[model samples]
Target: MGVLGQPINFGVSMLDDKRQEEERLQVLKGYEILDTPPDGAFDRITALAARFFQVPIATVSLVDEDRIWFKSRFGLSATEVERAPGLCASAIFSDKAYVVKNAIDDPRSLANPLVVGALGLRFYAAVPLVTHDGHRLGTMNVIDFEPRDFNAENEAALVEFAGLVIDQMEVRLAAHKAIGSLTTLIKTVPELGIDEVATVCAWTKKILIDGVWYSFDEFLSQKLGLTITHSIHPDAAKGF
Candidate 1:
């Protein structure tokens, strides 16, 4: 019976943790962004960041409830990973910035899948993409195969680059939210419930906004690498 009482306290703590997580996640989701098919603008940015730092990989990653999704990537991959296994998860721990100079050498990254897995990435530096209102959307990261160090100048440069990434994310959030409201204007305004209707409504918002400008793919291209061209087929052109 005493142990049963202990469970009550544990339950309260769990609820507190869950509430905290939900609030944080709401802030993350409030950006009303992340995870769509693709876009040219986004691709360009990630590629440029990778090349600028001379790293083999770069990503604009969003830490979702269960997974860290890649909005853009330059050198290596686009697949999602479990949130518990993400190094960028640590970035959300602080208000500033985070870096992992050598993945294999550091205790944090020694077991990170992005390091030991197929990509063979040994180095990482993550700059959080933060909103002006202080919402942390995700990270702008540069990954490399060799163990190395960045001078003060380089760190400064990466920080600046990360700022640009945040700029894009802010715009994306605005665009997505607007689209979502407009679509649901035909229905009802969506709130926090995870009902299927709400999810679909959110997606509808995504499609409308994406088509208006660049798709998510185009945004990622510019963010990842400069080489991505946002040209569309003559018939497919919708004036975004």
Candidate 2:
């Protein structure tokens, strides 16, 4: 699967689906994004989504094990809602946009608390934030109190919005991972001077510590607690 390309892993056996769900949740956890502080990037996206859709609410929602956590919200007060099969939970099942033009008449949402209760939600549309590895993380969605038509163009635009959300997540995850690596490196080489990193043989890529040479990769794994893996780059694999 490509980051902003085709969808995958849909329509599988029930048992395989269960395993996939577990893997999906693991991928979500790896991001370490849940329950974190608000981010301006996400807030801006949701705000733009609300304005573009002319809706009262917009959100970047992440479906956790028991709740739908809002990474950012626009025009909505509550930070999160319980994970429900009728709402964001359902949206994450596919890469396509999920919509309810009129929740009052849509059987899928007829009994939902947000639809029948105080919030009185009447319209909703969402595009799932699917990762490059085919894991559906959550959604970039808009909500309205009144029903309205959502055309194909609108859906296409929403998909783009979802892609943006995924792109942001990818950047954020890389940053976090890099920081973690750096912190580990610093701790591992505490005696190294501020201006100097580690003593390494350039050609061999081996680090020297206390007169012993160690493979840079092994040194990182042993001293920094890092796991390294090799794989083809996503773009390069496209040629096949």
Q: Which residue window of length 10 is worst by lDDT in model 2?
A: 2-11
Candidate 1: minimum summed lDDT over ten consecutive residues — where? 6-15
**What TM-score, over all chains together, does every model reach?**
0.63, 0.73
lDDT of each: 0.60, 0.74
* Number of the predicted model whose TM-score against the real structure is largest: 2
Per-residue lDDT of candidate 1, residues 1-240 (tens digit): 111121100010111467767876788776655567665667888888888888877777777777677778786443555555356656655455567788788997776655666556677777777656555666777877888887777777777777777766655665665555534542442331223332223332333222344344432353234354545443223212
11 Cα displacement, candidate 2 (Å)? 20
